[model samples]
Target: MRTGMTLLIKFILTFVSAFIAFDLLLNNDISWILLLSLVAMLINYLIGDLMVLPAKGNMIASIGDGLLAAITAYIFDLLIPAFTTSWSTLLWFAILIGIAEYFFHLYLKKDEKVAP
Candidate 1:
């Protein structure tokens, strides 16, 4: 249940960030933005939240998440011709996601302390 909630939160954050950067700014299609957001969220959750957060602590995990977001977006931009975006846009997107990830990691840590 907790993990589900975490994923939901991550998805919401990722979707909003992607929507702003890809759809609103770059005029990309909503479907592409949605797909990109989903892919980033899942990979970030798996690697950033599950693996790195537990091992390396919040700062490292958040940085990793940001890098992961940028790399994912870059790959999508490369593979999908319609998904046009600049490096600056991708950088901003990664920063937004990274800030959100920092707060998210804090929440998870808090929950860990409260849980048995």
Candidate 2:
């Protein structure tokens, strides 16, 4: 169950990070719009990961999830034009989401290395 728990934590971290970053960077009100966007980003990562489930759970999964997360974040941003989401905003979320996930995964790796 460690894998599952780690995955869930990663998901939550990515969601929260994206939400907070978008809110702070864009200076937008934290409303349903931001919440839904975060959800979309999460969904994108989940679906992309599932699609590559046969990759023996390697870096491919992470790469796919990262790409999808960025796309979904952008799509959701566009889902509401009032947010004034530009390519830079999308790039920010994309890069940060991947970085957040990468660091979280590394934390898990470091623990595994220390474990008996």
**TM-score winner:** 1
TM-score of model 1 (CA atoms): 0.92
Computed on alpha carbons, the lDDT of every model, listed in order, comes to 0.88, 0.59
The candidate maximizing lDDT is 1
Q: Cα deviation of 11 in candidate 2 (Å)?
A: 3.9
Clashes of each: 0, 0
Q: Write the per-residue lDDT of candidate 2 for residues 19-104, one digit (tens) a residue.
A: 66567677666674356555754574456444553343536555655666667666666676755456776677666666665665
Model 1 bad stretches (over 4 Å)? 113-116
Candidate 1, residue 111: the lDDT equals 83
- For model 2, give the 10-residue run with minimal summed lDDT: 49-58
For candidate 1, the per-residue lDDT at 24 reads 77
**lDDT for position 7 in model 2:** 61
TM-score of 2: 0.62
Quote the positional error of residue 105 for candidate 1 in Å.
0.6
